[model samples]
Target: MQFRHSLTRCSAAAAVVLLGLAPGLPAAAASSSTIGVAAGANLEGISVYDTADVLNDEKIKDALSSIDFNEPTKVAVFSRQGEYSDDINSETLAFAREEHPEWISQDAEDYGDYWADGYFIITLSVEGHGDGQIGTYFGEDRKVSTSQMESIHEAGYEDFNLSRWTDGVIAVGAKGAKIMNRPWYKNPALWITTGVAGGAAGATGLVVLGVRASRRKEFEANLSTGREHLSNVTMDLDTTELSARTLPTGSRHAADLERRFADFMAKYRTLFARQQELEAATKKTRSSGSGVALSKDFIDTAQQLDATDDAIIAAAALYTRSATWQEAWRAQTAPILEDLAELPELLGGPDKKLGPAGSALRSFADTAQQEVQAVGTDLAAQVIDVDTALDRLSELRKQLTERLDAYAAARIGAYAKSEAEEKQMRAKLRKQRYASTGTRSGGSILDVTSPAEFFWRVSAFNIGYQSAVKAVNSSRQAASSSSGVSTGYSGGGSFSGAGGSSRF
Candidate 1:
């Protein structure tokens, strides 16, 4: 009875030791839960088999069938026992001895002292005997540390209790819960927040820039427009002043003056015809000695008529060259009238009444010749004055028109360039906004700082335009003054000569 009691105590102690080392067991043996083997606690006095020997251990497989291997198993076996009894089967003992020959005389030292402190023990038993052969299997020095072993033991206990078993096999393995963690770059929320913020900031900056650009463009456009208008006004004023300066003063009256001069010539020709008729009548009356006095009168009258005819021809030549023949007539007519009034008196006489009559006729002829010479000189002078005035007026008109036209064209071109530049700036601003935010903006696109700056630019352009206009006006005025003085002088000289000739 005492022997049986000792066997039971040994079995219980062995079971406790086996239980402690169970987490380190082979998978096949560890899966069987219906075996009659004792698994020990604390792994005390346990023997472990080599990996090769344990794989071929048939007795280990049979013993595992009777125990609850679903629970973590730990085993402790003694290498030495008291004298053998008949109940201890010789065949099993002999088989264990043959398989584990080195286990027979091994020292029973503390497993922790033999190996590292955290190393667990494994035992190979034959037929449920306490006197089983023991061998030690070293724990992995690189992987299995004391702290890791403790953690495994704790996890095993929890898993064994919670898991189900089927046909003596554990449903779950211990390694299932030992995985690795996730990295930081895969967080969608972080990337999303960054992208949104960056996009918003970029868009806002673009919008502000665009607004400023647009305002600048508008200001430039207005400035250009103002300049153009001012230039146009200036050109128009210049043209007007120029035209006034160049216009002929008496051009409209020229034709009428010419007609009056022609009528005066016709009258003079009639007087010449009357003198010829009187000479013919006197020649007929003087056919005998008594006719000698009549012959003298006729001969003198004929010479006077010839002089009158010569004066009329000179007058006609002056009228042909004058721009306004009426002016020519005025200058010539007074001289011709003076000669005619002196003619009859200069002819009054003393001689044979015939000699007196002959002297009277000769006097009339001399007076007529002087009058004709005076009329010719007056007509030539007046005609030359009229022609000079017309020529100067024509040249002035052409120069003024050309200058005004060129100024207008320049102003228009400048306006066009300014407008084009404004448009280009606006387009560039729009492109910048789109590139920054992937959207279009609805405001000005330029960078303008102040209203004052905007207005100043516009005012400057206006001033420039006004200045150009003033310059053109000044130029035209100068042309008018210089050209007008020259024309006036030339016309005055020509008219003066005509007046002097008229007095001859």
Candidate 2:
């Protein structure tokens, strides 16, 4: 049975080889990665000298030998070969076939496969012409340049012809090290932004910071929506600016915002009402003189929580006619319009009369549009910031109320005359808390204050609440970092031999 299984495996392997070799079969192109496969791995370099020139140079040999490959993250020399080729003629190919027969075969493309499997496969060609193609055939998507080879060769040759053999080889080897060096895309923290269309996947790279792991599609969608929303808001503000001359008494936009503000007010009022009711009931229960006195610190903190609610409501009220996000966009539009005002003639009103200055005006208008778009983007960010702030407040209210309930129950338990009485009073307090607070939302609030003990006593409940707040803050940071358009060469990643190259 073992023999039969082996035969079947061999047959499957042979079929894969045949398929890979078929003429019409497409070669596997270089894979792209925003995060490179070998991002954090050390680079191992190899040099293949086909001519007697290198072998005859003691300095070149010493420089090559001096490199140490034992470090976790540096380049080091691997080997020097007399002749090299992409086909079976190269010593590297023979070694691959003999040692890693399973990994190397007729259908294998790019020597980087060997590199990936932990063997250094960088080949330095003594002669540039045939060696240039080595990367195309053996190295996974590594592009070898003949021009680069010639440049490095000429530099070495200038010294070499004058019997500066050591200088020449060292120069060539140094250049070769640069050319063969593997680029590590280790920037884990990447900023991604959405395109004008706002569809989730239509995002580009915008900013690079410290390394951060990313969930590509999900991140793209979120950033795109955020940008798209901002753009819409900007456009709305711009329209209002353009039509400022008109009286337009009742604004649909203002009304919509007003309704939202009202909803927010209602929610805040409900939270405040529950807080007062709990405070009064707990006070009444304590006054029974059952040896239960509520902590003054807790009461003060609860009052501050109520104050925070008031501040948030006040901010909403200030945006009665127009929100800051909208007003900011409107302010930006005035400048853009002023810049375009001179171009109205060039813009050719109705008659389509683009005069001699038409082209210049058109150019100016385009620039102005871009500036306006940028303004809109800023406004959109503001919108997100404001909304996130409100969400955090809601989270804080939920946690604060829950803590209040727990404190009340604990105090009532202490005051109970008997075990049955303690249980009855605690149950009644819990029911009253629920009736006043309603259902809870399972989300953490952002903790804006540091040294929380100044605001609230250090209780077990307070400690847990602080931990949850930290988690929320971390999540917010990650989300904010993910917002932007990613730009240039971060395609997910590709390999090319720009480090070094040569031709005979």
lDDT of 1 by residue, 146-171 (tens): 23323323333332233211111111
Per-candidate local distance difference test? 0.32, 0.36
**Candidate 1: count of backbone clashes, pairs at least 3 residues apart or interchain:** 38
Query: How many residue pairs clash (N, CA or C atoms closer than 3 angstroms) in each of the candidate models, in the order given?
Result: 38, 30
**Residue 67 lDDT, candidate 2, scale 0-100:** 43
Candidate 2 lDDT score at position 189: 17
- Model 2, residue 49: displacement in angstroms? 7.7
Off by over 4 Å in 1: 1-190, 238-504
Candidates in order, TM-scores: namely 0.13, 0.21
59-115 per-residue lDDT for model 2 (tens digits): 454565554322222221212323433221243344434554432323346433233
